[model samples]
Target: MEEMLTEAACRLGVRGAQVAVLVGGELREAATGIANAELGTPMDARTLMQIGSTTKLHTAVLVMSLVDEGLLDLDEPVVRHLPELRLSDQAATASVTARHLLSMTSGIDNGFYDDPADYLATLSRMEMLFAPGDGYSYSNASTVVSGALVARLTGLSWDEALRRRVFEPLGLRDCTTLWDELPYHRVAVGHAPDGSVVRPWTFSRASGPAGSTLCSTAGDLARFGELFVRGGAGVLSAEACAAMHVPQVSLPTRRFAREWCLGPYRRDFGGTAVFGHSGTNYGGSSTLLWAPSTGVVVGVVCNTPHAGYPLAAEVAAEVLGAAPYDVEPVTRLTADAEPYVGRYAACDLRYEVSAVDGVLTVTLEEVASGRVSPPVALLPLERDRFLPERDLSGGRGWDLAFVVRQGRAVRLVSGGFAARRMA
Candidate 1:
């Protein structure tokens, strides 16, 4: 396992990483690379790496624990418990529920935030992407608010609640949301694509619920994953544990998954379904996956940013002994193609889907940098979905999907976010 870990990290240009896998009734572990590239500090089992948004799973478990205790209702409007929550869309602010937020359908803009301390206040200046429960847009804004609600209802700060209910109860030795404590732990710093240390470390404390500040070793994460794998491990109710993996909403894009649960997104590989969440910080990425069928739980934390998926995916396949599942491509268009062609923008990033003489293509652009990518041909797929013939950056393709309203694609959802159509 250590040999495989080191080989994968070296192959992927990862500087530091840790992994923990639970199989049958035994747990195995591995670590490779450096905790600090400059100091060349060796990564180890005790070295903590930012779990990134995988923290959302812990947060969701915390939220679900409330449901088990009868302190919160999943379907009840979140505002019912925390009225101070407000969005630019008053109705959505009022109507969004714990279910919607946890399921990524709250319509809150996963807006850019400057300060974690202003997490809730930042909402007042932001707008909703869609109506509550109307569609899915991965929103950190929604999760932070959920954390705030947890604080309100538990009469404990979100971190405190997690420590008291989860970390303490599960006997997780090294997991924390507080950044000040990182100095005392063997924590991994992040590295950018160029292999340079990431500046400003992290922008996670304020987005704790959305998974920015949490850090842990691979073993601690795997143990927490046991909650889902083993009927909540008696920490949370069996019913609530089951509900978190059940599809609450589906993403039409292959970029994520076909569906999302209360916490993690669900995907199938080698015909076996696995539920887990992947998270990315400034320069790191991580994933925690558990397969109920095999009773296998895998946790991967990589300090090398932006490319953690391949590491996690490879590690999971190695542990699950999964085989490749080939998917036949859809060559024929099944839906009206006209409504899908449009220009969409999220801040300075742009995507333009166009049809020229019957050949459909998408042009990606970084408007702020005045850089435009070569057009990539798009093959038609079912239900208004499009498979990029190749990635905009010239890598393998990821399928794309749109949110259509009144006969037009209102947004292009791919590459981890939904870009609003620019009319």
Candidate 2:
């Protein structure tokens, strides 16, 4: 397993990685390379890897605990608990429920904000992608709002509530939401695609509940996954946990998961529905996948930003004999990629898609900083969905689906967010 970890991470250009596999009540652990390539710190069990938005699972579980206590209701409008809350859409402001937020069905776009005040203040003027529960779009803003809801109802900060509810209940020792606690622990800093360290290491704190501050060791993360595998393990009722794995909304592509659950991702493993989640920050990523049918859970931590997909995926593949990213080979291009050639906007990033030599190419431009990413080829995997051929970053594949309106394409949907055509 150690050899496999070293070989795969090295092959993928990753500097450091740690993995934990839980199968049939036995847990296996392995680590490879350097945790901080810059400092030459070796990866170990103590090295805490930022799980990014995979922290959403923790928040979701925390919120579900609130539901179990009769402190919150998933179907209730969010404004009922926090009357001051308001969205850019008037109808949505009164109607958007907690279910929409956790399920990633909220229309709120991912925006940078300072705190809850700035988040709500900015969202009040911003337009959403669609009506609440009408479409699926990953929203850090929505999760932040739900985090605020957690704070409001619990009379405690989001950090305090999560620790008391989810973290402590599962007996997870090497996990935390506090940034100051990082200095005392073995931590893995992020490295950019150029192999440079990710400075600042953190993004918007307002989105912390959406996974900005969450960090954990691979074994500890696997233990958290085990809680769900145990059917909530007394912290959450089996029924409540079951609800979280229930499909709230379907995705545009099945290359990953066919649908989005209340908090975790819902996918099929050997015909049995399984739940898991993945998260990526600027230069680091992690994944916690649970295959309940097989009584297996895979937790992987990596210091490379794009490592979330294939790193966790590769480890899981080694354990389970196959992973989700191993797609059926697209031997020949059958779909027309020309109609999708246009500019599309997704939150802070804008994409410029053009056909070079009649092949679809995507160039990413950051709206806030005006940074442009190198153009990459998008190969057709299915009808309107295409897979990104890995570039220098070693980032793995994600399905990019074009949404057509009228007779032309109007949006490029990838991951969970839709990049609306801006050209």
Candidate 3:
């Protein structure tokens, strides 16, 4: 299995990758690639990596724990608990409940620029993109507001609430919310694909609730996955764990990935439903997944900012497919060649999907934002499967791809973008 993973990493040109398989509480660590591409630090079990939006799972766990204690209600308006929050849409603001935020159906647009000055104000300024519960749009503003709600209800900072309810009890010594908030030595420095170290600037702190501060080692993350696979014994109740698996929204179609639960993006890998979330920051990426029925969990931590799914998927497939556990990869079929071909843009986000000379090409609207490059070009890798050019971000050369289901692109598999188009 180690050799297989090493070969995959070499093929993908992953600079630093760590894979940990947790079976029935036992763990196996397989690592290849350099943790520090410059000084030649090999990734191992103890090395910490940023687990971006996967941090939302932990936040969701904390919210569920509060619900379990009768201190919070999922159906109640979040504003009822935290009266200070005022959305620009008065009606949605009054009606939006905690559940709406968690499910990413808050009708809010994603407008989080990497500007600290606009962070707090942006949440209240963006108009409700749709009515609450109308559709699912992955909104950073939605989650950050959730963090604020938790803080308001508990009368504690989100970090303190997380510590009291999660980290300490789970014995996750290395896990933390804000990496910079922690002592400098313990946090892993994020890196570009070329091995140049990159630290989060002022803009990073603004992305708090959605994909903010989470730092952990593969060992610690495996332990986290184990708790979920084992029915959330020490952390949350079985009922709470069950709620986490309920499907709240149908994701865009993708061939390589599975569907999504309320919060976690899931896939049927090796005959078991692998429940987990993939995360990406500017220069780091991580994933934590587990199969409860099989008692198999997998954790992959990487330093180069955007290499989560491939590492996690490869590890889970190898360890979970040991024996007796067998499942077929669902072959995705697509036929709609019209609805998918269009130029779509909302606010600062832009992309165009069109059939050019019998081939479908999706181009990013580069002239608009003018970041590192334009929207990524995705070339078909298989039937309904496509792989993006690595180093597309100039330095973060993660060769990720996507699957088109029906006419919508599902999970952003390669880039770790957690967006699904609305119907």
Candidate 4:
């Protein structure tokens, strides 16, 4: 396992990497490369590496634990708990529920924030991309708000609440919400594509609940994954555990399974059902995969941006004895494609749909940068749904699904956020 990880990291130009696998009730671990390139620190089992959004799983677990205690209800509105919660859309601010936040369907705009203390204020000033529960849009603000709700309900800071509810319970001594919080000397530093160091080594504390600021070793992550494979025994109720893994909303990407649960992305590999989450940060990527039937959990982390998935997938395939699935082919465009060709806007993004040469394509424009992504071909999936011929976000495939109203497309839903049609 160590050799495989080392080879994968070296081949991919990853500065540092770690792998931990749990099989047959035993935990096996391996590490290779440097933790800190300047200091020439070698990677090891105890080295702390940022897990990014995989921190969502821990936050979800904490929320579910509260649900188990009957102190919170998933269906309750966010405003019900945090009455001060407000968004640019008053209705959505009042209507959004905990479930919506957990399912990534809160419809709130995803904004750029740098301070943990500013999360609530940032959310208050943000506008809704769509109505709550209207569609799936992955928003960091939604998860950070969820963390704030947890803090309010527990009367503790988000970090302290996590420590009391999750870390201590799971005996995750090495896991922490921030890199600077790590007591250990061995910590992986992120490196950009050009091999330059990504300084600061951590995201703002405000984004900790959203995946910007959590750090852990591969072995610790594997142990966390193992709890799910075992049905959430000591941490969450069986029912709560099942709920977290069940598909709550359909995802827009083909790189992952079509559906996402409360925390992890759900998918089937080689007919084996798997649930886990992946994380990406400044110059690091991490993945945690678990197959219940095989009782196998695989965790992989790397200190280079977007380089962790291949290694993690390799480990998962080897453990489950499965090969990678082929990409879904594009289908013929339908006659009803006219209704879907239009302009849609959400937050700082604009989408223009058009048909040329009897083929349909969508162009995405970033409002701030005025930078337009290459027009991506859309393959018909259903009457109002289509899959991009290529993954829109590099290796992660994002699909397009139109929301129709009064027999005409009124919105474009993809990448977990809805874009309203602009007339």
- Model 1 scores worst on lDDT over the 10 consecutive residues at 391-400
| Tens digits of per-residue lDDT for model 3, 1-423 | 679778876665567677777786677887666666556666766666677777787777878787887888888888877676677788987899878877776776665656464454665765566678765566667777777777777888888898888888888786777655556533455666455777652247656666766777777778787878777767888888888788776533343234445566666764667778767775567878787787877787776664455555566566777312212223222244344555544445445655644445556644355752444445544444444533443333333333455655542333333333333
Which candidate leads the pack in lDDT?
1
- Candidate 1: residue pairs that collide: 116-206, 283-305
Error of 4 at 261 (Å): 2.2
Which candidate's TM-score is highest? 1
TM-score quality measure for candidate 4:
0.89
How does each model score on lDDT?
Answer: 0.81, 0.80, 0.64, 0.79
**lDDT computed for candidate 1:** 0.81
Between candidates 1 and 4, the lDDT winner: 1
Q: What TM-score goes with each of the models?
A: 0.91, 0.90, 0.79, 0.89
Per-residue lDDT of candidate 2, residues 273-310 (tens digit): 66888888754688888877778888988888865577
Q: What is the C-alpha RMSD of each candidate to the true structure, in Å?
A: 2.7, 2.8, 5.3, 2.7
Q: After superposition, how far is residue 343 of candidate 4 from its true place, in Å?
A: 2.6
Cα distance off (Å), candidate 1, residue 44:
0.8
Clashing pairs in 3: 177-213, 252-410, 253-405, 254-403, 283-305, 284-305, 364-375, 391-397, 400-414, 401-414
Task: Give one digit per residue, the lDDT tens place, for model 1 in 170-227.
Answer: 9987888887787888888898867878878787567878877888988999999988
